[model samples]
Target chain A: MKQARDSAPAERALFYTPESVAIDYERDLGDPGSYPHTRGTRPPNTRRETEGHDFLVRELSGEGPPSRSNEQFHYLLEHGATGLDVIGDTPTQCFMDPDHPYAQHAVGNQGVSICRGSDFVALYEGIPLDRVSCDHSLPGGFAAAGLFLAAETHGHLPELLRGSAILPPLFAEDTGYSSNLPIELHMRLATDSIEFCSERMPKFHAFVEDTYYISDGSVGIVDEMALGFVELREVVRRLVARGLDVDLFAPRIALLVNCRMDFFAEIAKIRASRRIYARMMRDEFGAKDPRSLAINVAAHTSGATMTSRQIGNNIARGAIQSVALYLAGVRAMEISAFDEAIRTPSREAHIVGLGTQHVVQLESGIADVSDPLGGSWYVESLTDEIETKITDRIAEIEALGDVVELAENGYFRAIFTEAMVDRSREVVDGTRPVVGVNINEIPPERDTLLRDLLENRIAPCYDRIEEIAAWRASRDMGPVVTALDNLERLCRDGSNIMPGIVEAMRSEASMGESIGVLRECYGRPYDPMGCVERPR
Target chain B: MTPTTRLRVLITVLGLDQHEAGALAVSRLLRDGGAEVIYAGRFQLPETIATTAIDEDVDVVGISAHSWEVLHYAEELALRLGQADPPIPIVVGGSVITAADQVEILSKGIDATVLPTAPEEEIIATFYRLAEARRPRL
Candidate 1:
């Protein structure tokens, strides 16, 4: 009975043993802050002294218009939040202004909506661009240029601005739906940002591969690892082909992967990711900088795993995921609030989410030892297994020619569709029982807790007609037209479009106007009101 | 009744919420369960969602959400569908909506509400029940 119970097989392996896994300490596990860095990218507790802090507790935030987000940012900063992760709304991300018909209902619904550089200035008002690090979660492209223009508006030097502009995959949503712009156009914008950041903003990360989006597509952990690396490699290839060295920008790029409820598997996934990145940067890409070898990882707690049945239990889920992120030695992390399953997290929920991190950091002592489980037989063995799986998956993707081509053709999308269906079936069929959902099922009376929570939720506020009227009436038309013409010329010539974008932003050109210039240059139809019909 | 006739279901997202995992999963599940599925994609307005349902002649419209936007948009969608020439059955599902909220949305003309963890049988039954109920009007 003991043997049967102990030998139960996991998803990858049938059984576990040091000899069976063939673990060699020198070859497989290296010291902390050393090559391979399986133990961690740094020794335990050194990050606090060297970086003046451990991981930055940056909460993913933003909603309503720029002024609203600015106030929210101040509130968060006043409440112990160390950094900013601005979430741009759909219209801002798709390069549409609030005035667009398609954007009317969506403005300020998910995140802060901005139409030009001035919106960004207002969004970060009074927050010193030079002092505080920020991350802008912009979906489309050219957000880096937008941020640069915003900083410049405040008389901040381009070189002194810090933080990142996360280039979400070319596609807006992760459901394999059609993107606002085609793949090539998205690449052009991304490459433009990379080149501009490499030259002007040395401290800024022009792009970060967000595997959180990959996981949102319902792909498994191994697939997330494989696709994230492929994305970074593709970006590097594009940059290097443009005559930029690998080390010049690779150090600035980072990875923001998902942290699922699978504690040990998630730990192994993150650990293996670092090792793989180190090897690829050093050997394949011929990177010399040690900073380039060290992959900066940020983890977003899994929203998919949150149970709506008993939402209160989600705090425990977040705590478990936070531990996984911290144990894996992530540079930054965000925990989804318990109420995330029911609505936009309330202020109390945000406090609780941040408090959970504090508990793990202060009381739990989980962050005291870097990669505390690094040498454990099980963790080490699982790390090796996950690394092999990730490499194998990438090899399969490489056989399909360029990853971008494959992605455009729906190769990765098909995988996620299938994985999502299968996982849902497992849950529905009770083969994989979620605690508060499938088992221990209990429906609260009247659902007063959730109802009260909903009462506290504020609907996003935006008046498109009025706001657009005021904005258009204020900006000087001559400079806007000249800047847009210059942008079109740069786009037509295939020159880096970042400088032109910054110029256009400086002239108070709205996002739609900037995108319109590019569309005209490409001879593509300009319709901010257009929707990409979901292809069957 | 035609022997090969299949129930056509339309799944979509509304407002600014971009969570597609639940929507995509439901699409696949319904597809595998022998229903023809049409995904309208995410960030669509309530008007667009209603127009698509009418254009596609879908038997049931399923809206997915992951934020409070769903509460407002789903209600609007439900009202729109109710006002259609031949009102279509509407089902709203997601992780964030509570039972009381579901009741409120249902009262606003949504035909059914499915939780993220709802079983396949319950989902299928709700769709068929609502679709069948709307057949006489059609």
Candidate 2:
């Protein structure tokens, strides 16, 4: 039989790897402390603080609605996690308070439920405000809606307090976000957030999640990802022109990313981002402050791959993801736990998650050298190739029109469908090994870890859920009602919703009410403006 | 017959879940073995899924999940299908679904719980096995 041709090189799949992507493993170009930022994001200083737990520890939410996610907050602090990344429940992140009807089903699925000053204060009970570094992945829902919810809790946005508040408006609208507000109107509010954050909070990172490039079902070319950054760069320049100190805000503008476990592909993404952002910051935006040019990033493990079967397998997966992100040159990082695929990570799961980082950061010696793979022939070549692919995809999207147009046209949807089709085939075949999932025949070892949560009959965090639910029920309804009305007015009138959300929170509005108001204001999901076609 | 008039088959993976690779491959194998596929993207809810299958009038449903919580959910979903007098064939796949989960699943009235390591040919063979097991018995 004649041999068939190998199709990898032709499809440009060769560049999507770790061996080709992870560079410079052998040489020590610089110590961990070097300024050019190669030997890990920081220097090799064995600060005792970074030793005991994760170099960066984020707290899980707490037991009360009016209560804060303080249980884990205090734990992270007492346990020596220097920086804290706290997640607000969906209600708060969406600028809603707990009592809103929209929030009934989603109170504490992801994190803590914070509605007002008291909740924020309580959440931060033991943790000092100034010392903790927080990343609030709140989207404004087509307007700068969730910013204030974060502000009341964190004492002020970090970027703004540090004189670098550059809150970029949410642009990747394909995450099922279709607002009743006009695109131009949304643009105004986003820029408003940039302006507001620039002046008020120091060290704040007004940003957009970058997982779309690597994760979202929308699989655009590498160019589309780069172009998204480019468009964002333009948004920054537009702000600079409007007299927001471009240097301060733009520099503090960080990229929220998901480091997919495709190890080298992720490494290449970071290098591309830095090189791309550096050029954009220095040359395009003319950002002179070293802070402005610095490309800071916060990464999560790919949510897509976080699975439910053989839950313990996610630990190794999370570790691989962390190693990938750190390799990609992120200064600070957070890791999801092995149990992440199951539900909100248990306290023990969170600790092991933090421990995973410690193992990688301290024990594995990964952070001992700078972009260790930077100079490698395979890595550099792949990095360049990834940049090319990303750039091409961005242009393709642009040619089709802006992100909104691509979204409206389902261009993004089509790409993801195709990607899914391809991946589903891999799973059906034996091409990819998911360990205990697919290839490995063994069951979890007896002490695989988390004896109680893994082996025993621990109940679902249902008690935690019920606690927040009851708190929402007990709160005064009058003020929350009024807050929702004001927020609705803001949403309807094309006004920036961030301030209104904060105002509502101050009134003890629960997250649900706040989010409900906006959902009503934005109306239901999406009404295809031009499809007009009859249903099948 | 209207192209949509035929019974539909929904194959999806839900939650912070994404691992279309194996399922994608399995989907093609099933297609070759003669099954219509309604491939919903990741993070589909149970209600949404049930509604899709009902609306599509699918005779067989195959769902994939990666995380432990989702696998447990998948099992519950599969078990629930038997209650629908005209039961739909349910098959589950993903990295997490294992030989043990498969056995527990069979007892729940699920036809099959496909392992990620199984060959495509085995998936086809199993697909037919389940289909035969589910043959109309008026």
Candidate 3:
């Protein structure tokens, strides 16, 4: 059988030698947690005191309404999940209410639908806010506002809150997966959350630069790192320009990267990413705090690599990717479920996915040491090569223009589209050997059982339109209107919109209504889909 | 269909599902196969898709349904497109699409369903065949 020996995406050298590496330990491999944290973020013995596991096994779990997803949260916790990663449904992520005309079909389809602060309250009904680390993967000011209001309702102060919020990326509008708010207004709203969290949420990560979107959009590993670092730098520049110290918000900044099938390259890319980030922070921003120099890297197994043809093969893929992530010394990890390529994972598949992490962490003993593959000749050489490639790629990306200009001019989209086409062509031409897809073949009828298992695992649909209507009827319109008016004024006056958003949520305003005000202030349609007109 | 007369196809994604790789890939494949591709991008409503197809006078409309939104909106989209004078043929494809989903969508009047693992040649051929079938009715 013919096989491609080159590393994917970047097509780096397949083999390396000591002469090729020539890595100086003192210069390249500093002690863990020291300046230029290339080996790992923390020392080997610096595991979390509470849990024996070295890394936090945070599984992505959210579907249906807040109440339903809340059950999954508790289920995951009971099953030994160290943290919670909550995802919002399409409607909620886009800041549209379930009642919106364009949002009806997608309500509660992909993730939990949280249309209001109360929904967040219900989502974490009995879960203690301060005790568990949550990744609020929803991007926007509304998600942060809802979460903040929920924490307050549960008697937790902003300072006591734990977890992270995914700030909206500049390429969000270009990708079409997130809100369609203009890039400038979107960044403004995101900056508001960063500012709010930097001041109050001491233990919370204000911005998690998720390169998973870029990689899953068919971008190469080198480009993914380049784009991620570029976006992170732009965010840092904006925050610093606001008169905030580099050390203040930089410590809270983190990355969520994708773990693809190229095991060694993925590991090298992650190691290089840490080194690049540390250098950028210390050299570029002049950060003094050690915490600001170290970056927290959370990885998710690439969902794009999961094949719909041979569903069970994805389990092995996830396990192998988990091992790569562990060897690379990721702080937190989430394995993609085998059924993810088909639909939202079933409970059985979700548990198995969680078990994959546990098996690797506890059973395999790979986590006993930090950066176990740190000094290997091949890994070190590849890491150096990747580091150089990513630096050059970043320079090329910077030369194109700023993040916002690249986003508006469709530069990222063009590259991603080209990559996607090339990938498909590779599969078609047999250059890429996807086991069940292009290489080893299987008849469709033979996989009926697997198909049944994945297809039958459909998330139950909740009538959120009626639920929102009833909740709206139960709330007072007076406070809601006042809060929305205040939020609009804050948007117009160039003030942080987080406080106003929190006020609206506290007043029981829906996310759509709150975002509608921001959209109107920014001169866009009240509805991102242009389905509804702004009220005069 | 004559070789000189290029087949026009509109590629789009409906609802809030933002995974556009499949849609974009199909657009590229169709364009490479000598079809006049009208890429509609994302965040499109079913009504808007039908209007775009009719307005562009495309023979076939390809939807990249990467989520269950297609299951919910397929009937409506098919109905809207069916109301056209020469109803457009709709093809849905995505990684998330299952054989059962293909059956369900086909039952809803979708003209064809292509799996993500389908060969580029087969996919291009399917779209061209759908376009050829629609031309005679036109």
Question: Candidate 2 residues A301-373, lDDT tens each?
Answer: 6644655555666778888988886676675566766665445567777787777777788777776555777
Q: Report the CA-based lDDT of candidate 2 relative to the real structure.
A: 0.55
Q: Number of clashing residue pairs in every model? A: 2, 78, 0
Better candidate number, 1 or 2, judged by DockQ:
1
**Cα lDDT of model 3 overall?**
0.82
Regions more than 4 Å wrong, model 1: A1-9, A12-17, A20-27, A43-53, A170-179, A446-451, A519-523, A528-536, B1-5, B15-17, B43-52, B67-85, B115-118, B136-138
Q: Of 2 and 3, which scores higher on lDDT?
A: 3
Query: Rank order by lDDT, top first?
Result: 3, 1, 2
> What is the docking quality class of candidate 1?
acceptable
**Weakest lDDT window of 10 consecutive positions for candidate 3 chain A:** A1-10
Best by DockQ: 3
| Best-to-worst TM-score order | 3, 1, 2
> What DockQ does candidate 3 have relative to the true complex?
0.70
**Once model 3 is optimally superposed onto the true structure by TM-score, how far is the C-alpha of residue A418 displaced, in angstroms?**
1.7
TM-score of chain A of each: 0.92, 0.74, 0.95
Better of 2 and 3 by TM-score: 3
